[model samples]
Structures are given as structure tokens and as C-alpha cells.
Target chain A: MKAIITTTGKDKTGILAEITRYISDANCNVEDISQTIMQGNFVMIMMIDLSRSPLGFAEIKEGLDEIASRSELSIHIQRAEIFEQMHHV
Target chain B: MINSKEILETVRMVDAQNLDVRTITMAVSLIDCISDDGKVCAGKVYDKISRYSANLVKVGNDIATEYGIPIVNKRVSVTPVSIVGASSGAFTEIAKALDRAAIENGIDFIGGYSALVQKGLTDAETRFLKTIPETLAATERVCSSVNVASTKAGTNMDAVKMMGEIVLDTARLTADRDSIGCAKFVVFANAVEDNPFMAGAFCGVGEGECTVNVGVSGPGVVEQAIRNIESGDAADLTAVAETVKRTAFKITRAGMLIANEAAKRLGCKFGIIDLSLAPTPTVGDSVAYVLEAMGLESVGCHGTTAALALLNDAVKKGGVMASNHVGGLSGAFIPVSEDLGMISAVERGALSLDKLEAMTCVCSVGLDMIAVPGDTPASVISAIIADECAIGVVNNKTTAVRVVPAIGKGVGDRVDFGGLLGGAPVMKTNAYSAEKFISRGGRIPAPIHSNKN
Candidate 1:
């Protein structure tokens, strides 16, 4: 399944490195990645193909949360279908 | 690969320009939760709201953070309480329950504690209308409204009389805070179904089971865009309309994205999008500024009417094209005290109550944020509301009045309700009595349009 992951929180070093490492380790192919700073907050949106992943949503969510907690960030994960269903008019 | 620089630049533009989605509101209809047993009805009402809105704020915040936009308020509007209150005194309980649920769920406000008695009042609507002063005073973050007249329903003279009393009583109840209770109350005529605004907004019974509605606003942005354009460049009506349309399109898109995301995250249905150019007390964020951008020295000038009409129409067209769910009273707001430019105009004697009403024919709300002499009798105020409602009925559009009669104050004085209430300069009104006309309590027949095929 293709998935979209977004991370946002206080700015910090190595946030991109840590999150990208997690995605690559899960055997997911990264489709797109974008990051920005707005109103003093850091935000990142990533599109990835998770069909080759070894875990389901819950497991991936837990693993991301652990990394997020360590990095003092907040993360959200949604299936690509859900994302398009919301944005596509 | 997506260029990180492009994304960063976009974020920088938004942050530096103060561009962000203002509100992501959930519109929940309480029509299905109605029951004859008051206790059962209240219980069901509470359960439905709690179940539907429990994670609303959390999800909104989550999505906002994820998307790098600021969702300032997470609000909910239910089916008008009076509709469900037809068989019970449960309105009061429902009001309390809705307020508690919103507070508990971390939402800023819960709206639609209202009654639509435009043509006439049912027994339950009358009861609900009478309880507003107490309801507003007793609960926090619970907004209430009443529709006393409409084009289709004509003007309800009886209901308008009761509303005058309600507004006065509500002001008196919260008089300690300079009538702060009145701030949470609004009396509307020809009320709309999909408005995401407060004090006058209610989920109209004509809408779907559940829908998302957006209220987009950006006076500051619009002002900035027009700042560099020479006054002569905006002299032509078509140019002014195009400018307003383009500005409205951008603002509506931002608000629509946030609202749709919030609805998705909450797993509830999405609704309409309201494209009102709501203003603030800040500099350059006034509807008056838009008027001035059109070469008018002030809002009450002769050309102001023509200017406002074009601006309102352009905003509606642009917003309608941006979202399929566009509904509500989508137009510009001309609240005297709420907009800094308006307050200045009033202080400078450039804007007047009569002119404000004329502008309301082209905008969303009418006679908003206007303060008249305290000693002004309730009957005269009702007359003012009736006059504005007549226009709504004749024109087939939604219009409302929120006039605050500041007690113990006279003409040419000023009352500051502080934030959001902004600062209002008390204006003079004709010292005429309409008591005889208002005391006659009955329904004003629906307009000629209601009889059509």
C-alpha cells in the first residue's frame, strides 16, 4: 500500500535522517519528500510505497512514535487512498 | 524528487504573510436525535454530540500540524435546538450538555442553540426563545440565535417583539461585564443554512445529515494586495470585481483544504464553505479598506453601494468556483465596530446606520456591531431589525442584525468591549417611538415569492 507520512514539531537536527532511515529500513520506496518551516514550527510531508513493508499500520505507527518521541516530534500516517480521497475534488 | 526549497518557500510565504486557515468547523445535525421523552431526548442529544465530536479538536490540531497550517478554532453547529425542543424543556439541558461536551472535547464553541421562528413561533420555539437570556448567561462558549423573519416567511412581528425583549434581557443579565452576554447572542432574519459564523449561525434544518462548512476570511491579505494598486487602477467596476474575486479564491482554497482534512480526520461528513471576508480591528483588515480601495473616501459615500455590490458578487463567484460545497451567506461584512476602518469612519462621521443598512443588502450580515443610545427603547430597535428583515425577504437572501443598546450610554460616546468586540463608537439614532407598530404581535405574511410554483 502507498502511504503518506507527515511529521511536525519543534525544529531539530537529524529529524529527516531519522525518519528517512525508518522508511528505508521498512523496505518502503520513497516517492516524494518535502519539508518546510512555518510560524517557527518544522513540518515534513512524505509519500512512500509501503507494499513491501513487513508490518501493518499499527506496528509502523508504534515504531514511528518511538522515533518521534525521541526526536520530540509529532507524526501522522495515512494510506494514499485516504489522502487522495480527502484532497481530490 | 520534490524540491525541498520549493516547499520551504511556500511555507515561508504563508508564515510571513499571515496566511492560514482560520477555522475548521464540524456541522452536525441533531434532527435524528429528537425524541418525545425529554430525558431520553437530552440523553440522546448528548450521546450523539459526544460520539461525533469527541476527537474533533484533537484531529483538527493533528491535521493542522501535519499540513503546516494554523486551524485557529474547532467548532460544531448542531440542528437548531428549538426544532428538537418542540416536545421538551430539554433545550436548557441540551444547551448545558452541548456546552459541556464542547468544553470537554476541547472545542472553542458549540453553536446552533437557536430557533428559526421567522414567520411565526411554535410552542417549543417560543419557549426556547424565552430561555436564551438564561441559557447564554449560564453557559460558556454556547452561542445562540433566533430567526424572526425571512423573505419566504415575511416578518414575524410577534417573534420580533419577543426577540427585542430577549436581547435587552440578555444584555442586562451579563451587564456586569458590560453586557458580554449580548456578545454571544444574535437575532437574525432570513438566516442561512450553511454559515460557519457565530452569534448568528445555526445548522439550518434544510441541510444534509452532516456536512462541513468553511468561513474564509483575509482582510489583511486583500488589503495588502490592493495596497500597491493605484486608486485609479481600481476605478473601473470590472477591475475591482476581478481583484476581489482573485483574492477570495485564494482565501477560500486555504479554508476549504483545512475543513476537508478535519472532516476526514474526524471520520464525519464534510459540508459547505462560507466565503465571507470577515474583518478584524487590526489595521488594513477592514471592509472599509476594500471600499477605499475602490476610490471611496469612506464607507457611506454615494459610490460605496455600487462598490460593495460588485465586491460581494465577485467574492461569491470566486468562492463558488473554488468549492462545490460553497453555501452560507458568502459576502463581505460591514460591522461598524468590528472593523477598525469602520470605527474610524463612524468616529469621523463618514459612516451612518442608514448607509450600513443599504450596504447590508449586498453583504452577509446587516447592522452588525452597531451601538445606539442605551435609552433608545426596545421598540425602536425592533423596528430597525424589521426594516432590515424586510430587505432580506424582498431580496431573497440571508440578513441579520446584531445591535447593542449600551445601557446608560448616549450618543457620541464610546464603549470598548475589548478584544474581538473591538471598540465601538456610540452613534446617534432618531429619537422616534415605534411602540405602537411593534406591540401588534402577529406574523408578517410570507413574501410574494413564497406563492410561486
Candidate 2:
């Protein structure tokens, strides 16, 4: 259950902390993190192993959406394999 | 130590801002490989190209990764394949070999399977030009071009007429895949050599054996740079030009370093640097955004021309200072289907073909990425190409038409060529016949400007 999460949208404070806390509470292990600012917006791409997830994909997506709404951001969660298949071509 | 919050905020800004280099193209001219023996010439041509461009993809990829910038495409443009094929009588084989070389070297597209027959054609030129359809259809990586007229040479009526047939033939041959052949072919009236831009770059006969040209683009970067400028301040033409010039200068310098490095590594002569602000299919990476930044409600409006002219001039002035050899059509491009802002403009009824043509009079490439109805007559398309070419010739600048007449699609219909073709909304054209006018094929005399002693 390895996943890559990409957060993009309006720039605001504590976005990274809130998302990381959510993942930590879910018992997911963070593998790598990278972020960049482009065109006046903030984006973060995090690769995490969710093998010990407290919840599955749907629950994680729902939880992340709630956090994103509160922070005024957009969150996308996809399987690492899916990301690789889509981009590595 | 850098604060984590500060670094995260910076990352967000970089992604949202869409700061990236669109392409890093290597121009390799094959003019010097000319020889009397056809087989010997083909072998030399292949060996020369392989040796020169072997490391191009690797170098471009390393630089892109090093800078963390997305260099989306790595391409090569040669001296017109026609020039290389003229004496050798190896047009088809040479085209195949060139395509193979590019594919093996991992380049995206290889251009200059071309001919410059503005006034008249040589026997070799005619044979090479006629084979473009077959060559383009047979090869995946090869792109082709033809220059039918120039201000000095006037317009070649015979060549223009022949191109009409050629375009129709090429389109028909590749019609199964939405006429992808036309995607690889462009017909020019005032085609310029030393253009780092494609699918119309050819090493003009006037250029050195090999030279480096840079095509720098940062539409999204430039757009973001001016986003916060007040509308009142943005309305100041000089202020807007200065901002654009500064951004263009930085982007051009980056390209210059890469071109010079690639040239040195390849051991070929470095050429001029082209400072074109090429846009991509992605959102925010658009020339129209640059125009919108200048306080224009939309591109193709009345003030668009003035804005574009100033921007083009400022880019040239700034870029000329950054690099000694600045050539190619170094300006903005207003292609209808290519840029998201432009597509939105068309959808909003703010942009039209005529207005686009007028914009090209000052911008870089002319009448680019326009989509017309599937059933549009070949003659009408030729007339359209002729009119645009006439502008290039009259203005003594490079002008080209990369129009896609999507089969089975009509006006207002959208055809998605996907990826870089973006989404082209079919534009309406006048139904009036230009058959009588285009049918009378004769050369248009070179403009008076070519009479230099």
C-alpha cells in the first residue's frame, strides 16, 4: 500500500504540518518528500508507505479531503505504481 | 538553517507558478556532407549526424535533471533535407537514415526535410520537395518544410500550386490517424534559416556549416512575473515591455549556455541563439497570458497588436545583448490551437483568424496551429497559406502556416490531437472560391527590398 500524495492549490500556512500529522495519525511511514513553488502556488509531492494504514484508500482520501478543505487546498492520492505508470512512460 | 515553513512555502510557489523550460533543441545542419556519390554521401550523412547528435539527448536530460526544470522536448533541425539530397539522389534513404538517427539518439523530432523554392525550383529541389509526403509518412521522427516565397523572391506560383497538392496528399495519406502527416509538415512562404523553432527550421545556405541556435520559452514564468502589476501600471507599454524583456533575457541566457555546451561537446561550430517564447499545451504557459498581463482583456483584441509589437522588439533588444548571435523568429506566437489561453480566447469569441494574422505581422511565426473545417477546399487552404506567406515575404520575416484541416470535423467542432496538439476548435473560413486566383500559377516577383547591390 505504497502511495504518492500530491497537494496543490492556494498557498497557506501549516499545510505541510496538517497533512503530515494526518499521515502520522494513520500510521503511514513517510518515505520521501519534495515540494516546489510554481506560478504563485504551493505544491508538495510526498511518497509514503501506507501498509500499516489505519484506513484504506477511500477513508484516507476522505480524511485528506477534510483536511484540505479546512486548509483551502486540493489533495490527490494515488498508488505509487499508478503514478509511475502514468508518468514514467 | 532554512525554516521548514519557509521552504514549503517556496515549493508551493514554484509549482503554482509553473516555472520551467519548455524545450532544449539542438540544430545540426547537414549541408557539408554533400558529395557526388549517392551511397558514399548517404553513409557520410548518417555517420556525421550520429557523431554530432549522439550525446544530445543525454546532455539535455542531465541539464534538465540538474536544474530540476522540465525540458519537455529534445529535438534536432538539419540543413534542409532537400539541400542534402540535391546532388546525392538519395532523398528517401537519407530521410529514413535521418529518422533512424534521431530515434536511436532519443530525440523527439528531427526537422529540415525541406526545400527553399521561393522564386523557382531546381531539378533536384523539385524532386526532393515532391518526396516530402512519402518521406514524412514513412518516418516517425522526421518533420518537413517548404519555402514557396519570400519578399525578395516574391512567391513561386508553381511551387505554391504544387504545395496545395502536396498538403492534400500528405493529409490524405495520414488521414487514418487524424491526418497526423500534416502534423509533421509545414509550408512556409518566407522561411528563415537559423530558426531554432520547428517544424520549419532549415540551415539557410548563408549560414556556417554548423551553428547553435537556442529556443527559450517561459510564458508561464513571464505571466507570473507580471501577475501582481496593477492594471494601471500594466497599461504602460514601456513598463510591460521592460518586464517581458528582462524575463526573456534570463531564459535566453539559460538556452545559450546549453547550446554552447552542446556545440563544444559535439565539436561542431556553434551558431546563433534564437530567443523565441514558445508556448505549450499546458495551462498558464501561453503567449496570450503575456498579452493578458499587459492589461488586455483577451488576445486578438485591438490593443493586442501594439502590445505584441513592443514585446517582440524588447525581446530582440534584450536577447541581442545577452547573446551576440541572435537569429530565428524571436518573438511571441499566437497559435490558436496550441496555447490554452489562445484556445480560451477562440472559445470566448475574442480571437479570429484575421486578427491572428495581424498579430503575426509583429510576432514570431505566422498563422500557426490553426484548425479549419475538414471539407475546406485545398485551394482555399492554399489561398490561406498564400496570404500568410505574402505577409512574411512582404515584411521580409519568416512566416509559416501549420493549419490542420481535421477530416470529419466542421466549424465550432473540437478536434483533440492530444498532448502538444492540445485541443483545436475548428475555425470557420470564408467559403468563397479562390480557385481562379490560385489556379493561375506564376511566380510573384521578389520584393523591391531584395535589390541590394
DockQ of each: 0.09, 0.04
lDDT of 2 by residue, A12-88 (tens): 77889999998999999998898878797888888788888868666777798798787788776655542232112
Candidate 1 lDDT over B1-453, as tens digits, reads 334443333343245444455566778888887887887888887888788888877777665555555566778888999988777768888888888888888878888989888766777787788889999889988999888887766888998888778778877787676666777787887788778887766777887776767676766666555664554434466766776777677667666777777667777677878878777776666788877877788878788888888888988887887778888778888887778889988888988888888898888777788887777777887888888888888888888878777777778988777766686988887677889989997877887777776
Point out where model 1 deviates above 4 Å. A1-89, B1-13, B231-235
lDDT of 2 at B245: 73
Candidate number of the best TM-score: 1
Cα lDDT for residue B176, candidate 2: 71
Give lDDT per model, in order: 0.77, 0.75
Question: By DockQ thresholds, what CAPRI class is model 2?
Answer: incorrect
Q: What would the per-residue lDDT of candidate 2 be over residues B201-284, giving only the tens digit for each residue?
A: 666777776665667666776777567555544446667777777766666665566667657765667787777777778887
lDDT of 1 at B46: 82
Model 2 chain B scores worst on lDDT over the 10 consecutive residues at: B1-10
Worst 10 residues of 1 chain A by lDDT: A80-89
**lDDT, model 1, position B50:** 86
Model 2 ranges off by over 4 Å? A1-89, B1-14, B35-39, B231-235
Task: Please give the lDDT score at residue B450 for candidate 2.
Answer: 76
